[model samples]
Target: MSPDLKTSIVASLESAAAKAGLNLVSVTQGTGFNGQPTAVFELGLPRQESLGRSLNLELSDTFDFDKPDLLPEMTAHLAGEAKRLRNPRPDSYVTLGGLPLAFRKFQWPFHRSTSGADTYIVHGEIRLEDGREHGLHAKISASVTLTFAEIVPAMEQPYAETFIYNAVRKTVDMGQLEFLKSGNRQPVPVTTRYYSRWQKKFLFTETDDNERLRYLLSKVYWLSGVLGGSKPVWIADPRDSQYLNTGEADLLRMAGHEAGEGLMVLDGEFAAATPALMARAAEYQAMLEAALDFTKPKFNESMRSGQANM
Candidate 1:
């Protein structure tokens, strides 16, 4: 583990403990077994002995406990994350996913050349049990921060924001319509109150537009369920991603993106969340309505005439 990762975990846990109305005693990140970085953050109870008793540990009944540190609750969240991190590494590989953005997948022009920067190869050596040396080679990684300071052309924020908002609105409207059509459920009810809340959340607040857009996009997923329809997208199937570097391709294709081109979307929990699914459903409804409306002239007259004849 990295020192930064450990530090981050400690900080997050401490904050969580504080919010849960628990007294935070100490958060420490230090070197652990095998000299790997580790963080051990625990909430300290005034009545330490009393808190320890509530836990379901093998020794929970063996001690007096004080605070109700939600170990079981925290452990549940960790289990999902750890499962993702330790999924059967069929190819014995792991990945730190990239920031989601639409991008063209570039092939290395040469054996080691890519659209990325040129970096020197790094080397390290490891000792085997027999005292033999095993050499480890590390290539320069793709660094995003290096380009952060580079000056770029100006963009029309107003026009771009308008276009995206219109696109997003179309999706939201669709989901809302679907909900109304269902005759029993709320279309997540985007009235002045709801729209105002969402409008401000995305426009006024210093929030990520992509997140808001995605949240709205997820409305379609929810709308489908409300209307009794579902698009079952797999969270992360091992069978689909069995081959090395294949998961990325599978993910992109499933989401209707190019096989090699990347896409950004929520993970398993986020996708399954009520709000996100609803947003997806809304987006889908918007798309369906838009297509239907576009070809309305061809069917509207017939529909009206058929109704009149009946």
Candidate 2:
């Protein structure tokens, strides 16, 4: 990229970051693992430089600097990322069924699968974050099919994070992933099946209005009531709206209904679980238990027949 283009991109990103309460400390150009030119964006919270994160962008393949709309689109993407990073646990998420998991240690800039498979893979781990010390988690290798990879603009952190995270969550929801105290890295295939070319979007799970409402309540109950010391949690996260096949305004509307029902208190786009919601703790606990059970490996007739020998 030309120096002028780089400068313009950096300036736009910095402005967006500042508006979103993040400091864009620096933007450095480097070579990515795929041998492509990459831009590394270092960001920090205001007055807390020690707590910082790096977001990577692949420049050559992902953007066309000559396009008039490129800068604005990039700026909008950065702003959305900044909002997600402002959350108490940006890497943490709650499943629709109430299982809270924190995704971490992801090896980014997706690599060609070494297993000779026609896919790109990123390795990561997800730990159960239900405000308990059970230490249950899973190591995973998320693989993107070559066909599916075509639709992804870039394999870098900024572009692929939300969809990959949602794929993992969806895998768990489908009972295809097992969390254990220890285990080898299991596979989570991300294929074109998760995307709708017609809709031009990714769909993790099909949820109705009732399911959406329950998901919002469960998110507040766990993220705020259980883990966040009763602080309000952002309810209308764009990442979530994308994952749930809904819009931010719809999420806010659901939050408003939740407030009316005394299930939570809404402060703009943030919400905290109310006592009325907490009173149904047993119900939430049961949901988590059921979700956990669903994720466990079930034995087939043949496996069960051989269990006695084992």
Candidate 3:
């Protein structure tokens, strides 16, 4: 898409935001995963005292295929990510504060993707200091992409007012209102406090790793029930297991590790923990004798010859 198209869309979006009573904070342009142009708009409104909530409107033109059915692709991508995280090669290993913490036990309770939108849930856990662990729960959403083909037309009649308004409205309408009703404005600090206290309280517990995992899962499941108005079964179904593949579990584990690292970072405990985590990961990988699998793939001349052997 041309720069002109991007500019027009941004203008239209700003106008729409104004109509919707949202104050525009900033609008910046960047590149998407495939080098396609992207614009991010930061918007929010005053609630009670502090800046109520921050909302982001991200527009990208990274359309790889025209009207592509992204459901399977998104699921496959998550599956692949999970696999890599489960059995990360030495080089591909993720590090936080220089620590090579790994994630474990990934589960996807929900996933939905279309050409327009994508959303998924990831559940896992990461081991922390002194055999302590924490649950990693994420609900990620990749919003709809807006192409130049869309921008040009939107600049004309309706002027993208409906599109922009709906995009911003649905986000707030869905959960933000409920969150305000629950009277938890500063959720990040609240979550951090709970996590820090939990870690400190359990630091000296003699509970086994399995018991720790059970506790983490139980807490997350209960939280989900409270937030979602439905209790998720704590059991792992064989059919659900079928959705995952090799290495996906590894990614799930890595995600968990990342989650644990985030909590530590928030609590100011990660700096002192990195070196030991990296050492632990390296030693664990060495014990597995599976470090060679991370090596780069070699090109096969015979396969490229393409003489229809099959």
Candidate 4:
């Protein structure tokens, strides 16, 4: 990408973020592994309010605007994305001690030379100063990508009537389903496309720790409904997935502890792509669990020694 174009795109994005009351933490221009022009936009909640918990929204886009006319179009494309980032849908599972479980989307933006209209995600995050006060003092994060085109048409069908029967018959054959329900827990709810509610508004819920599971179950119910349609699928592959840390990971590290539990669901395409990948991830999960067990005793000891000195 030319320096002039890069400068223009950044300026356009910064302007949009400012107008939306968002802090444009950083923006970088580069090329993707596929050699396509790429840019990453990192945004955060305004700094005026200081809360222990935080939210960061990152967007990655790949474009090709080699022609003169397309050069100017790049700015418009980015501006549209910036607008999306300023708003996102509500899909909360569980909120933690001082932080809420953050939801993010792995939207890979690409260019289409064809004539039809294409739907894209307008991705961003909302911060509630103490939204996490209700759940365990840990981080629980998940990502899902829903397409507008895929979901609107399927809203009237009996989701459970069809999905439950199919899932029961196919559960054993579907490796991803088995993996998602690993601990005898219900399958992870992920949707391919959702009717974009967060695209315009954000609802705030302030509660204590007692309602943790209520929030989780509600989120799960929502996920099951949204993810039941045909075009929208749950993301299950770990490789293409991204995780968000709203200070929980850092807090755990600072206190000589680590996340005891977490989950990452892959989109259907990747999840169903191969059996070998799932097996490998399962193996890695086992190793990680063992490591966490070894570290827990040390963490406990450190806490005990600190308390003794106090």
Candidate 5:
């Protein structure tokens, strides 16, 4: 399910990358307890010159990744997500070589590219001075190359799109990060609501989680209990049994939980004469009618026992 893993990683990475002037090139997922994933990403960019600037980022073999390094930090995040999917971490699954820098670098007098020109094709062997070894095995490297013309074109000016804002939103969503001091970005609140007629306290908000399934199961269980439970019954006399006193009868019949013949009992909270609650009264009324019917026959049958009154 490389595609599946790719889709999942890309979905997460693109969202994170977009706000940072980058985008996921691709993600390849493999199988195993902790199979390594290979993901490629492109910055929202025109393939630029020498994969632009290469700065010294430390990833010590003994640096205790426990210490903070941006690449490790970011990769760690990606790996955590992999863990969520029950997959292996990047370190465990794949051999991540030196991180490469891909961007544009203006040559000396930095002349931009000439587009749609029938004039002439310029050529030069451009080499990117990226990797170097400082004292004590400290490595500095540049893993990219680019043509000046390819990097910056004269016709179309490159506009800087900082992924800072979107990145901030994603970071805040993660909640692991306090706001980064990189640029202007604010955390937005996520609103979640839960409502069910079967239960009270139907609202829950989280700055962290939107527990949709929990609410769904709770509502489901409540409904199952109700639909599968015995109904409460309260009987009262029904004076007019025609078409449910028209609108009033209709409302009460519904509220009282009537099923053609029997009025339904209701929860105690909504026992007022509200249109819905009237059904309880209707159920009571049906019960009264039954009792009255029984008594009327009983009165007649009892005449033999009390013939003088009859």
Candidate 6:
């Protein structure tokens, strides 16, 4: 990419970030995991430098700088990203059972598995964030099968980010992933099983009205109440809506009901946890413990005997 085009992209992203109350710290060009050109956007809050994130966007070979609408489209996507980053623990998510996990260091632009598995893989780490200074985490190699890859519009960051993250969450929810303080990279297979061809959608997990309410409560409690110093968080994120197979309006309605029940305080599209919600801290803690135990690796008599011999 030419320096002029790079400047234009940075300027547009800066404007979008500012409008969303974020600072565009810098933009750097680097090589992606797939050996393609990548732009890394360093974003931070207005005066809080400690709280920030770096977003990696891979630029495909066929990218055209001359396209008149390209800049606008990229800017629109960055604006949405800015909005998402405004949430407390933007990279973190809560499981159905209340385990809060923070995904980090994901090498973007999926690459083919070198082991000849006929799958595209991206590496990342998911850490347990249970309001603790130190906790368990897993280095993951998440792979998408060829059939499942066809459903993805693009292999780039902006296009595949949501579904990929949701896949990791789903893997954890199904007890297919285990978190440890130290361990080898584990495999998370993203296959056609996650897709519904008839509905033309990616199905991660099934959640009901009561489950949705519990999810919202857990999100606010952990993200806002525990981690964010009681700041309000956006409750109707499209990503969460998609993960839950529900509409954004439905999430907003759920938040409204929770606010009426005094479990949370709503600020338009955002919600903050209340004392009533925090009162269930023990319940949420128990859920987290149970989930951790469920995901722990089990050893049979033979494996235990082998370990004893070693």
Provide C-alpha RMSD values for all models, in order.
22.7, 4.0, 20.4, 20.3, 32.7, 4.0
TM-score (all chains, Cα) for each model: 0.18, 0.83, 0.25, 0.30, 0.17, 0.85
The numbered model that scores best in lDDT is: 2
lDDT of 1: 0.28
Q: Model 3, clash count?
A: 11
Worst 10 residues of 1 by lDDT: 94-103
Model 6, residue pairs in steric clash: none
Which segments of candidate 5 are over 4 A away from where they belong? 26-35, 38-310
Candidate scoring better on lDDT of 2 and 4: 2
**Tens-digit lDDT string for candidate 1 (170-205):** 333332212111123111211122123333322212
lDDT of 5 by residue, 255-279 (tens): 4443322223344311112233333
What digit string (tens of lDDT, one per residue) describes model 6 on residues 197-275? Answer: 9998878878899989888899899988888777788888877887888888999999999899999999998899898
Candidate 2 lDDT trough over 10 residues, lowest sum: 57-66
Report the C-alpha lDDT of model 4 over 1-310, residue by residue, as the tens digit: 5677667666665665566555677776644323455677665546653122223322233233334544343333333333223222222322221122233332223222132434222212222222224322111111222342243222111111122122221221222222111123223222332123655211122233333323222222222222221111222211111111112232223212101122212232211112222234344334424422332323467666786554
Q: What local lDDT does model 3 show for residue 95?
A: 15
Q: In model 1, state the lDDT of residue 74.
A: 45
Order by TM-score, highest first: 6, 2, 4, 3, 1, 5
Candidate 3 global CA lDDT score: 0.30
* Candidates sorted on lDDT, descending: 2, 6, 4, 3, 1, 5
Worst 10 residues of 4 by lDDT: 237-246
